[model samples]
Target: MIATNEKLLLDALPQPVISIGSNRHVTYANFAAQEFFGSSLNVLRRQHIVDVLPFGSPVISLVERCLDNSLSFNEYGIDLTPPTQIGGTNNGRMVDLHVTPTEHEEGNRQALIVVQPRSIANHIDRQLTHRGAARSVSAMSAMLAHEIKNPLSGIKGAAQLLEGDAGPDGVELTRLICSETERITGLVDQFEQFTETHADINSPVNVHAVLE
Candidate 1:
């Protein structure tokens, strides 16, 4: 926990604030910091900074640099996406990072980090990507639907004609062909759903239920 006055000040700021120990473990995380990392303060406190940041993140290096030289650094457009995934409906956030050396009671190097979230940039990027994918899906669905349905119509008509002229067993086979073509046509129709629009929101989620 942070000291009373310091905690109040940090929590009041819109940007995330974190206090990291010499060992790279979190000492304190303000309210916004929890939301920034997609984690709780308790989880952040237990884990090393490297555990939360993406692999090869520049932020990690900056933290180390600040600790080693007792210097302050201000960086822009830093990506804070999780290692497992990057940028399509992202589970992570982006920010402008600020790191500075801080004093510790044990005379060890520590760091104070501030995160200025740039989530709007990610939102615009995600929307553009979604639109591009939707267009591609729509175009492919139209082309394949046009090409296959034309052939299917001919096949079904041919099958119907054969059913009239053939023996009982042959008629059953023709009917089966007609049924299969209809089923395939139905499958192709489903592709159109991808082009439909939907709302994008950060709805409240049941975390415990998901874990269970």
Candidate 2:
């Protein structure tokens, strides 16, 4: 009864977690794990790691390494698609895999595999990339704001002046030109603001923190 309760507790965790035996068969899969792989506990337990995971998955290699070394291992941002399709879509999550060895019996080792998905990790990567790209365009934004904006504004003013004397079609074209120039100028102004705030933030963190 206590063991069943313990298993239930582990299953309550949000991240997918599984245990792999030395023989490459899966020993246990938590609820989240079952959901991630789109399988039930009975099916998962009967399957080998390779059978569950897609072909050429790095996780297969990582699990093998952990068993061979009898050590804990972790890998980040891995694509772990399962072989079975769920609703015609891949039943896999991009995850960080952590494997720690356990000795259920003397000289017989098993490992706990923790699967943490990388959706949040990918978001951070994109945020950092956005900031870097924003920084890269700082000089260009400054140049455009000065060299281009003033001239463009002058052109817009000229168009507005001509609009009064223009035919109906000519007036519409001039208005479009003015609107486009204003839109471009607004974009350049936004790029300039991004440069001023480089978004450099510092705090205590861990790889798992990014997951949160």
Candidate 3:
């Protein structure tokens, strides 16, 4: 049995971890591994490494090789699709694998496998960046509208005040000033749309219909 402190430390790690015993049995799994495999530690301990992963999986080979060679290694971009028996999805789960060979206090050879899932992590990062950029655009549009509209208002008022003092020749110049300010104001108001959000509508349609 794993000591309480050791188990706690393993559980605290964010990445999934599984320990394979010399007999190729799953000896231990951390909390992250439990969640990743969709099984409790007790359930996993009853199964062998091949039972957990597919037969002839790279992970199986890595663990066996680690035990045989007594060496640690890293493998990238391996897809260990969760077993169908568990509540895992059918989608490909790409992960970077790290295998470390070690001898414990009991003088037994053990292999540690830590799984770092890539696809989901990268997807979440991309989403966060996209949302952050959208928020920045909205804030910039709002700031620009505030700065431009205030000056435009002052200029429009000044033009109206000047219209009375001017003669016929200069009256048209005042009118042109007012009209140009109004046009620019309308353009600035259009920027307000960026601050508002609209729901996206999605539906599937036939490609042949579009081609026709």
Candidate 4:
């Protein structure tokens, strides 16, 4: 029988979670784990962790470490190749794994394993595209501003001179120049804001609070 707390923990985790006994056999797997491994809980419980996952996977190391040291082991960027279902092409998917000893009593121990994927290449591609877009927007904004500034100044000067010479009729043209310049300035300010660099502070925060 599974403990209530243990069941709640397994169900709450966002990523797939699996528990392995001292014998390296899967004792339990969360719903996410079932979906990811393409197997039901009953089928997975009957298999060994090593059999379901690739041999010598980083997850194996994590499991070994937790058992040996009786401590939690958290690893990042682990490449895990989940077992492919029959008749399915091997997608060669990789995942990150984390293992921690959940129970240890009278020399009988069990570990909780969490799985997450890290597609670094894909993330890099996305960042590069974002940078390219920012750069393009900056260049276009600068070019447009430069091209318009000189003509705008000339128009403002001419409007002012016309206002001085003509009667109230030319005052409207001067007002137009002022309004147009204000609009252009607002656009340039927006462009500058977009070009500014953003700083991300990396520190441990309460993940539960963030979720709430």
Total clashing pairs for each candidate:
0, 0, 0, 2
lDDT digits (tens) for residues 1-212 of candidate 3: 45689789999999999999999999999999988887899999999887889646788888888999998989987767666543445445668889999787888999999899887776568569888999988888888888999999999899999999999978899999999999999988876766744234589999999999
Between candidates 2 and 3, the lDDT winner: 3
User: How high is each candidate's TM-score?
Assistant: 0.55, 0.53, 0.54, 0.51
Query: Which 10 consecutive positions of candidate 1 have the poorest summed lDDT?
Result: 192-201
Q: What Cα-based lDDT does every candidate model obtain? A: 0.81, 0.80, 0.84, 0.74
Clashing pairs in 3: none
The candidates, ranked best first by TM-score, are 1, 3, 2, 4
Give lDDT tens digits, candidate 1, residues 1-212: 34689888998998988888788889888888787666788888898888878888898988988888899999987778755446556654667889998875668777899988777876689669888987888777677777888899899999999999999999999999999999987876675445443224588999999999
Quote model 1's TM-score. 0.55
RMSD of each: 9.8, 14.1, 13.0, 17.3
Per-residue lDDT tens digits of candidate 4, residues 65-93?
78767888777656456655433553445
Question: Residue by residue across 1-212, what tens digits does model 2's lDDT show?
Answer: 11477588888899898888889999888999999888998998899988988788887887888888988888887767787763355543567789888775356777788888878668578569877887768856666667878888998999999999999999999999999999988886766665653355688889897898
Candidate 3: which stretches are off by over 4 Å?
85-90, 121-212
Point out where model 1 deviates above 4 Å: 83-88, 119-212
Model 3: weakest 10-residue lDDT segment is: 83-92
Report how far residue 139 has shifted in candidate 4, in Å.
32
Clashes of 1: 0
Q: Which model, 1 or 4, shows the larger TM-score?
A: 1
